[model samples]
Target: MSFRKTGAAILALVMAASLPVAAFAEEEKTIEPTEVTFWHGMSNTQEQVLTELTDRFNEENEYGITVKLVNQGNYGDLSTKLTASAVADELPDLAQAYNNWLTAYTDKIVPLDEFVENDFDDYEDLVEGYRAECEQLGFIGALPFNKSTYVYFYNKTMFDELGLEAPKTWEDMLAVGEKFMEEKEMPAFGVDDLAGFLEASLAQNECEYASDEGALFDNEAGLETLEYIMGLYNNGYARLIGEDDYFSSVISTQRIGGYIGSSTGVSYITADDFELGVAPLPTNKKAAANQAGTNIVMFAQDENQQAATWEYMKYLTSTEATTEWAMKTGYLPVRVSAFESDEYQSFMADDITATAAYSQVDAFFPAAMFEASNAVRTSVNTMFEEVVLDELEPEDALAEFVQIINEECDVE
Candidate 1:
């Protein structure tokens, strides 16, 4: 027990103590599964389906993570909330957004590449054109969800009684409308807004609202599209109807002969005491086109939380999940695997209306935007509204609209 021996014994004891503490620290470092929050714009029937999926995930998943689903109201309201959340550093793990708004939120989002290497793998499972569109959005920007393409919706009972065939070319569509307006005292199409028809017209012509550089909807293709819309006004095939009139007569009880509307409207349209039928959008030539719907995007979150969010997102957009959603809501399944699967085909086979919608899947366009383009579409719509209501000359209105869009859209 001399001084040197005592010092050595004390040093050994200290090292032993440190070894046990370090071991305890290592043992306590197990990674805990993180909870994820999903904010969506779905309401009513759509809301119910989303909730059911989340509940199933919570009940069935092996991971000890909980998913909280929140209804953030409609798209506009949801976008507002999302922006506020980002400002406060309280953004949710996942958010549902349309492409237009998703563009604005790009900086705040977590690139999906962090989890999946090649997004094309996911794309390959979806329709080819749509897959290309998603791939163009850059590394795993969003998961396509809640998709829809526009179609011509007609009342089967009415169409049969009138003996009218579904329109193929734009001329056929107008001819059908002329008969409906003059003889049956019914309009061919009705909607709260005119922009839908304008886009449909552009689709009919194999033209887009914007080019790759982002020109608005007032180019040559745009003007031709507008002219057709003007024809609908002059020919009396349609009327200027708001949401109230649309749901009441043109839609609900099926008083109207035919109308252009979203394919996703299938479930709601069928539920209102009418037998509904769907046809491809009327085209200038014989082909067809319409815009696809929204996608799911993840905002910036911590690493563990980001991983959990993607796990739930994959479930939401998986072939199985999208198939269920397609069946329940009458939405087109975005996944090619889902569309080609027997389960999906069988679901459509049992329902002719859904089947018709399914057949038109080959004609959808990816949603995109143009530079300073707001004025173009809005101007075209305004021209239609004025002409239909007899507020402006069709030629003058369109000419002015084209001029305005061209001026604003010019490259510097």
Candidate 2:
């Protein structure tokens, strides 16, 4: 994929060759400066970095493009506001998006399939898994940004003292966790995001998470994955956030043997007392992890604003910008060049925990995204919790929630 071509490179040049050169070679029109409004949910340091980049682009880009950033609280708040704005036809020029969030309002958003195919050279530099959410739509609906994945972090010092090795597969995880549990009489393993863990596990085991007909997680393969997580919880081999707040906090305080959690979680873990270790998520029948993050999407607007928005969006995913974004924000870079850049390579050299996620980039894939996607995820989470807490039988819970989620997704 070529990234160097400017979006303004002879745009609107679809004249038939039969037309005389005199007709098509008229003087090129000068593009006026355009102000693009962008809505997002980033705050704190992330917001600071974004502001810094936007300010630089506004001041230095050859095209006079100004992007105004609007912080709309968190993602949930932004989603609700977007839907309302969609209804009122008052959407901003660009916004960050999850795959499912745009499915409901596709017409209002510009489909970038033609743009990327015709204008976005260097598309191949992007990680393939990042745009997978739009594969079903048959077009590039969004640009991947701030990508991350589930990673396994363990207490290496404790493992060595206990004569145990970090797990590489689900079977290893079960056996190792149970051995630690038996020895210490405490929970030995856990995951910070159960929903992401479940999704990645299903994919690893070749189970369909959802479809037009609804979820297939109650099937044999899906049940196997679900039960595996439940077994760890039921046998006291795994722990959940519950009343303890964050699992990362307990990782050092409670001395948990290991945990599967957000790839960016390394920054939050306190390693004062132990040698912390990080590794990619353990595999099962398949080696995979859930790719997590939002993508930037442009809403339909006037030609000038659209062009300016494209420049800003392109700048965000460029190799240099994405590499800097990842290093500062702890998110994965969107471009292969960014990932392999000297700056990023140096950062990865000093950070083993980040390597845990980056090493498995090839195995990363986003979960199925469609209408009511988050609803289905919540259903799966509830079902898992019910079974683990002994509030319902696994069979009953799975059967019930699968149907309920299907109805919520309007699958019939």
Candidate 3:
């Protein structure tokens, strides 16, 4: 053959080699689905919706991957189970983990960058904003699954009856909360606990719960932030509740006017027959919110199971799956595509509270760093609670808060 002809022949042979591999992938897809176990920390009504999604994925995927869904209990319970499993070398193939836990569990989890590269072209299309935060802590470690942001869950009917607008600022919140209590005979807002709420709001107000460098916690923002919670408690606007209970009970029963909770709290609202309104957590002049909810993390597994697990993980956060999960369970969809889908748009249209929650996602900052950074926050909560029950002076409690955080949350 002539030199040109020989070169063309070589190119054709290379193309033929690639085509066979592509054809094999298509043909091999007909084989039995791989089995994957997904251990999660959702319960009650949320568990039902979660199972439905896993069933849907099983029903829809051509790639033979069967997902065995397991509820490992709530956050604390799940974390303990995961830790024990890790030590025993028996962690689930895939798991749902809090963003904070990512740091502690990074060793056992696979970084998802390779999976994103192979499975999806635009990883950013899968999730945004907080992707940087996720990556910062080791991006490859997990996929954001049931993510949420703090939103003010309010009683819309009461607001209308009283001609009250959604409170925008802390000052406005205080004024409205006081008026609601005095005139409407309601506590203004109910909180399950103040630590998480106060940390998020203070972060929004440019308060550093821990330093930006992740080195220290006792800053002006941190102290002022605690004082703000003290202000709320002192004024009787926010009734502190326990972590084990749902504040929706307080809202539905009309025991409280509203509550500041996660966008994910909608699942709890389903059990109660009440009109709930959702709004972004009341902001400072500069609006900010800390992201909440869990991520789908992978544990150490064999290569075959890892590949299969990635497939299921990809499905969970896909436009269809995330939309289904968000609509049914009230967790905000992590993917931007999920928000634009007709399913998400229609759901938001039907519910004003959903619309409000959706609108605030842009202002959210993922609370991933706080799991390790905010040990002092718990101390602050205890001090704030004392102030709430009139057991301590606000300034005195705050001074103690500064001391505690300095010792605990400080990186030194």
Residue-wise lDDT of candidate 2 within 98-212, one digit each (tens)?
8777667888888787667855749888987886764545677789877788888888887887788878888988888888887877677887777677778888898877766
**lDDT over C-alpha atoms for residue 382 of model 2:** 74
| Model 1: per-residue Cα lDDT over 1-412, one tens digit each | 6998989999999999999888996654322466788888888878888888888987877666688888888888998898788778788888887645655456787877645562224645766555545555576677778877767778766677778888777788788888888778877776544665665567767676554444455567666766677677677777777445453345666666777766766565643565667777776743555656677888746766776676787788789998999888777787888987899888878876566666666766664455444455576567666667774455665665555556556632
Better of 2 and 3 by TM-score: 2
**Alpha carbon lDDT of residue 412, candidate 2?**
62
Give residue 254's error in model 2 in angstroms. 3.1
Which candidate tops lDDT?
2
Per-candidate TM equals 0.83, 0.88, 0.84
> Per-residue lDDT of 296-358 in model 3, one digit per residue for the tens?
788846877887787787777778788888888777787888888987898889976678777
Error of 3 at 330 (Å): 1.8
Error of 2 at 305 (Å): 0.5
Tell me how far the alpha carbon of residue 146 in candidate 3 is from the true structure, in angstroms, after superposition: 1.5
Model 3 deviation from the true structure expressed as Cα RMSD, one decimal place: 6.1
